[model samples]
Target: MDGEYHPKSEATVSVYDHGFLYGDGVFEGIRAYNGTVFRLKEHIRRLYEGIKVTRINLQLTKEQMTNAIVDTLRKNNLTDAYIRVIVSRGRGNLGLDPRSCPKPSVVIMAEPVAPAHGKEAREKGITAIISGYRRDRVDGTSHELKSLN
Candidate 1:
């Protein structure tokens, strides 16, 4: 598997990683079109905003993160792809203190994407199911933050 991409064997975080314990992190999903990354700037902007809202300190500049995504796509010889960007609270002890988590974990992954639906579905419209779960109040979770959990 010399040229093949391999998943990380073990993903680890510190005992105090807020993201690991409290789900205090944000993420973004992006898509690339042809050989160009679509809406990349907007995606990064949103990520920055999310970080600011969540108070997660990302070490990399937006430009660096974007370049990393593009580099991965090029390395894999992929044109149409999906990208996942995440910022997590750095490792720390089991305390509810932000100062303990000094450095933040930044991860970017890019991979090819294939949609399941065909043109017929797009033209005819698709059926959707309503979920029983209710969305969190904007005031409580600040709908703007795209963090999981």
Candidate 2:
């Protein structure tokens, strides 16, 4: 759905949407703690960076998007939850051409999510090591859009 809020069961995007058709889009996962959206500005900034690198001409500015998120949380009466902001290239033909899609679509979804592990698990803790695998090729389709801070 474009800019309107809809029930989860009613929310949908066209099959021809480039985002669905060819993975032509980007998104961000954010969280809210208590009554505040955590690192909201940073999330918006990073989201915009993705939008910039993907060349998606969003109809709303960063301020508007932030307002939208806050409004959504208010409407949902959610203070603590997981949030997802998804921007997809709108409907298009079968081809992989960006021009096929004129406008982009945005969807913001929020839901209460429990911690991945309970207090017992947290107390037990776990150990891990960083993966040596690199997800991108510097000379190829690297996902780096902005310099890491």
- Name the top lDDT candidate: 2
- Candidate 2 residue lDDT tens string, 1-149: 46799988988888998888888887878899776999999989888988888888888999999998988888889988899888887788999889989999888999876666778878998777999998777787544343111
CA lDDT of each prediction against the hidden true structure: 0.75, 0.82
Tell me each candidate's RMSD, in Å, in order. Answer: 4.7, 4.2
Q: How big is the positional error of residue 109 in model 2, measured in Å on the Cα after superposition?
A: 0.6
- Whole-model alpha-carbon lDDT for candidate 2: 0.82
In the range 7-69, model 1's lDDT, one tens digit per residue, is 646444465667778777888888887788888898888888999888787777888878777
TM-score of 1: 0.73
Error of 2 at 145 (Å): 4.9
Q: Quick one: how many clashes does candidate 2 have? A: 0
Q: Candidate 1 — which residues are off by over 4 angstroms?
A: 1-7, 10-16, 116-143
